[model samples]
Target: MGDYDEDTAFLGQTGPYFWTTFFLLNTVYLSTGFNGLYMVFIGSAPTHHCLIPDVNLTREWKNAIIPVTIVDGVEVQTQCSRYKLDVVRNLSAQGFIPGRDVNLTNLELEKCLDGWSYSKEIYQSNIVTEWDLVCDDQWKVPFASSTLFVGYLFGSLISGQLSDRFGRKKVVFISLAAQCVSVLLQSFSHSWKMFCVMFLFVGASQISMYISAFVLGTELLSKTMRVLFTTLGAFLFYCIGYMTLPWIAYGIREWRTLLAVLSSTSVVYIPLWWLIPESPRWLITQGRVEEAEAIVRDAARKNKVEAPPVIFKESELHSLTPSRKYSMLDVLKNKNIRCITLMCLLLWMAINIGYFGLSLNTSNLSGDPFMNCFLSATTEVPAYVVSTWLLKKYPRRALLSIFLSLGGGLLLLIQFIPDTLQYVALALEMTGKFGFTMCFSIVYIYTAEIYPTVLRNVGIGMCSSAARIGSITAPYVIYLGTYNKVLPYILMGSLTIASSVVNFFLPETLNRDLPETVEQMQECQGLCHGFRKTKYVEDEGRRNQPIQREAKV
Candidate 1:
């Protein structure tokens, strides 16, 4: 809706950029999730001793571990899945003969529970507190995870609404302040409850950040560039931040210190008032015409051009008017919108669950996590390149469907591979990651197209929140011991396949004016009608060029 202007390209100054950078990188909260937990194999568990009697032969034999025993003349040692080992109480409970085989009983387990058995229950681990990373209290880890997700869930729902209700810049300020306070307080937390309370606030704060960033970036760009800046720039940067998180955590080595460093970076946002301009579109929508005019005037002055006689007519700038008013009930009433919503939600859930679930599997993959994580992320760059090329040439629906199918197929194939060929499996997994990342990029563009402008933000928010639901589930799937390791991958792959099937029902968005009203959405009819207009435009442009050139000659 807006013309090219200097304000469209940059975030007025570097301060806002710094703020954006810091917020984007603050994923250290998510980064630390399973990183510390995965350290169980290499770290020590809290221990207690259990005495074995009437079996001494040598000093080494006397010191034999209580939880281990010779079964049928074969020695078998087992421990709980490194992350869940904290629940083991007594050595005899694990398999050891405390005094003799006849003396063991579950009712008298306290003998092993005390502090000397040095043997944890089989496959049970409490890696969250192995060595006090910050030496703080031990039980706050899972609470922190829940609090952050709660914050994210709250933010995900409310941020878009806030940006629409207030101006995007104002909401940006709000999110920044709230997140900063939460991060700052979380750092100072002396107990689990304090951390939880602070994280709830922090999660709410991120809503402002996402909404503000999207709005401000799209403010002055053309309709096409709006897609570029919002879809490509912001989304890509965020992914880059996600990809780099593991490396940063590895470098820092302590989760608490990493979180503290991320929080302190917020102070850099204080200067954003001078760096980023308020969103002009939001200004018009909020009835701040004068302020909106001034922002445009400032842009013209910086470009050494005169401001327009009028900044832009109110009628042309933005309109959310549809032929009929849309209530939440209306979304369900409309078959197309309902179909689009449910499909998008399912797609979102699957993507988040699979993406992060697999990410946490870096620990399960043999060899160094640092290398494995980095190598997987490295594939995303080429993914973006390929996506950019294919999207321009083919329908997004087709390309996305294909990518989804490919990702699912690769994941399923992973199960057939022998354990020794795991690096090959990892490579296949990266290919799947590439496929999903491309899908991730396309959905933002596609889902935004399915709704009229009036409900676009709400639609996007709801769809993304579904993905957040998947994000919440992902950690549990990988680490909760609820399902097997390959299960999340299979689900992600299957969901993508389902999405590809569903995509066929949705209309393609190409060479069509954005439907600003319900009437336009209804009248657009099909892709053929829209492409016909594009053909007409090309014909007109070609017709004018030769006459103009001959006249010049």
Candidate 2:
């Protein structure tokens, strides 16, 4: 507090900010229904046995089976001869409470239901397939994600305008509660339609969390640490979700069980409300001078130092005059913003197209699907470690566009390899993974930094939703790969290349601030207009950097 810039003291951490944020993020992340584990959400039936409900089979088929129905038009009430009628009635009300009473055929050579039984079929999948998606029958998987993006899209539009309207701390607090309930309902949905409905609500909650919470990190850290640590979330929670999922994947055979297990973990966040500090920056912005200064004072006490002058307080709060409202249309009405929006959206779309597409395509990659996905994700841990340093020195647009091309290129080259070069293809996939992972982190920082703070969340949300558009298409590409292995790679590669060109029209954002409105964006070229270059020249220099060279190896 004593040595740092007056502007940044609000940004640096004082309480258990890091741990509290991690827990909040982990909550939404686990419910994201990522990978096959999330396969539970869309009701993809597990490849396992089911309890064959007792039904009145033809007399010949009925001998060994429990008769669920009778010819008298009365329900046989489950012909478990070993159990008393009263026992069956009480147990029936519970509806297959596993381990309670309906033991799955424990003793005799009893007939049982298979996975395709009505209950099992309904139990396995969510109603997302109804959207008539092109992704596996699991098209709903990405659609479910789209609902979330839609939620994010809306949140960004609303939260960016409204979060500041309220307070950063309040918006995040509200988002946390909203996200918890939305995800829980989605996980426990009784019908596919209901599930989709839940997805929509939960998606909003999710975006609110993403926008508000992500902003919290930036608000809590120093400028030096702001971009770096805030974006580090792109890596931190990602790795956690990536690693944490595999263990859950194997642990739960039932999709419902999987979702239940994941959704329940969010409950730990309830106590975080009492722990984490409110955003002082947000307080200052909303004209809560006294409260904002109080937060600063509390920090002074905790750090054992004196608070800064009253003039410093006036600077932050006075600048925050209540002004014109923001809306999604704000990005479109201005040329520079429109251009930046287009570029960021396309980049967001491409990265997810590659990221989630490749992720879902793990079914086609060699080895255990879960393990391969996990190992591939583990690659990002190191990618982010290197990215934190590299992003600062480089131009955001140039570096990201080149990484886009590189990611796209490796994907295309993998198609040229012979089946004899299975390992070669896998190696190429890793290279692409690393590039996209880096781009994924960069895009978030770059997008937020480029947009004005007024439309910051909306701009990022639009990009995130656009990313979902790519995401929606991604699963279908992989689903097709089920029939043609090379199809997804070829299509994904082409999309990436096409989107990379959009970066040319956009401004660079390297160590910069976002605009509040489109008017401000039109005033300047973009957030960082200092440097922009063609991907080729950038790649050449990157190739020379022996430590972090653009080599496939």
lDDT for each of the candidates?
A: 0.57, 0.60
Q: Tell how far residue 420 is off in model 2, in angstroms.
A: 5.5
| TM-score, cand. 2 vs. native | 0.69
- What is residue 253's positional error in candidate 1, in angstroms? 1.7
Worst 10 residues of 2 by lDDT: 544-553
lDDT of 2 by residue, 243-281 (tens): 667667665645556666666766766776765667766
The candidate maximizing lDDT is 2
What does the lDDT come to for candidate 1? 0.57
On the 0 to 100 scale, the lDDT of residue 212 in model 1 is 63
Per-residue alpha-carbon lDDT of model 1 for 397-458, expressed as tens digits?
Answer: 67767887887788878877777787888888888888877877777777777677867766
Per-residue lDDT of 284 in model 2: 59
